[model samples]
Target: MARDINTKKLKKNAFRYSKVRGETASRIRIPGGVINAKSMAKIAEVAETYGNGTIFVTNRQGVELPGIALEDMPAVNKAIQSIIDDSGVNQEERDKGYPASGTRNVVACPGSRLCPFGCYDTTEFARKMDKMIFPNNLHVKIAFTGCSNDCGKVRMDDFGIIGMTEPQYDPNRCVGCEQCIKYCNIRSVGALSLVNGKVVRDTDLCIGCGVCVAYCPTRAWTRSKEHYFRLVLLGRTGKKNPRLAEDFIKWADEQSIMDIVKNAYAYVEEYIDPNAYEGKEHIGYIVDRTGFDEFFKWIMKDVKLNDKAEVAHRIYWGGKHYDRSNNLK
Candidate 1:
């Protein structure tokens, strides 16, 4: 029997109202895109028991169990408690499901745990960030990629955190083979040149991608011990404008990046449109409305950046605006 449902409440509770009447999908949050095998089995159990025995993987590293009866939401919630607990997702109560579904699951690529080119532990950082800001209703997207290779496609999100590492060059170890130079030109920005039987890295031109370090034959170039990041901001996809995030800070420390993102929530609360659809609005749209200068002031409040961090005074983004004209120029 179909019953009157509060669709708004349903969505906030992390259940997706389906096209089919009296059916909903349970959205499960998977921070860092890494879940244990036991949790995965539990999700499968939930699907088989409550859903149509099918699981839909979401792009944001979440899972959705579709074809669940609307009335079975409570049972579904209780069944998924173990998965929620295992994932370390913050909750207001046990067996009540996700408290809020605004902030999307933190997405990450396999970093130092698996990939050779990875500069840092992307999954660890993603999980930490998720812990700081979850169980809230904020239309924000954040992603972490292992390195500039950007396997995570982070540039499409609101906060794209790309890994970086400053290369430490040792002239003593360099054999003048120029392998670093060759590969840097091919795989990354050509910031290295041979000088006096050794390689000279153009510090001004280097984006800290550490390509030279990876190709160094005799450990002539090595990554810095201090892990750094390239923080790109405000990229989004929508009907009006779909754009990639621009560089906000380079060579940024992890703590400063986390603090900056945390501050952004306050900025959004102060400036988000009251009439935004379902009280949800992308941070990029809010930035567009308030202007970058204002957004910067708000986002940078009390956030202390390290000395090596380079911040962009201003950012500009260009993308296809579907809301505009159809006439090709």
Candidate 2:
């Protein structure tokens, strides 16, 4: 799990004019991966005025401006700092890492904040994640998405938050159309004709993909207000290496979400070897080598578990299945 100096090289080469090989390379963190036209313009100005006229975007949604001279690093930092200050973020707050630190590392899609199909406000929750649990000892990337659509590509991160909603059955509105059953790819739904010439739905099989709800003409499959989010950890996606994160927790609220993140960081800090590999930075590699169950127990030493149902759930991805029962129980 050597750190991909080559990946960094590719990134650097992509913005060749940025001169990343020098001693004073600059890295800029963008909170929630959010950027405004004005902020971008300021970045361009900084590139032109302070350093080379180029920028590189990181997978974590950070921007790096290379080729900055050692002497000019202070100026570049100041210029970027000023723009961040005028961007409605307080200077003092920035110093205190309000929009930096863990917040800066967060990448979130425009969930319910603006997207019509979004089931939740992923941006808002991402901001909360930055503030509450980001400053810990964890060194892996975390990503969030507003819905199962995963526009933010949460599956690629060490920790991922996916928005989800459970469908509610309206017995009165159900026309037994079986449209939902037809559209469901997961076969989580089933329909049967009733004596009254209407269809009845079996809710147990519904996987909550929303396919039925979208196609249903009768609007029988409506989303409930009881919507929460999904949490996954130790997942990675790429061509050379592909893996799916196991579900650490599901349908979690803000408080539970914080607890999960804290637990994850605690685990990483306790057992992971920092010098294991130069570029072996993510959590999945650690799990691959040390075993996830042992990792989980090391972190949950003081915590008590009441339920282990989710532990037995198998995670299927990358054409392989991983049973987490040993880790959970």
- What does candidate 2 score on TM? 0.71
Over 4 Å off, model 1 = none
For each candidate, how many residue pairs have backbone atoms clashing (under 3 Å)? 0, 4
Q: How accurate locally, in lDDT, is each candidate?
A: 0.92, 0.60
**Using Cα atoms with residue i matched to residue i, what is each candidate's TM-score against the true structure?**
0.98, 0.71
Model 2 Cα displacement at 277 (Å)? Answer: 4.7
* Residue-by-residue lDDT tens digits, candidate 1, 143-197: 9998999999999999999999999988988899999999989998899899889
In model 1, the clashing pairs are none
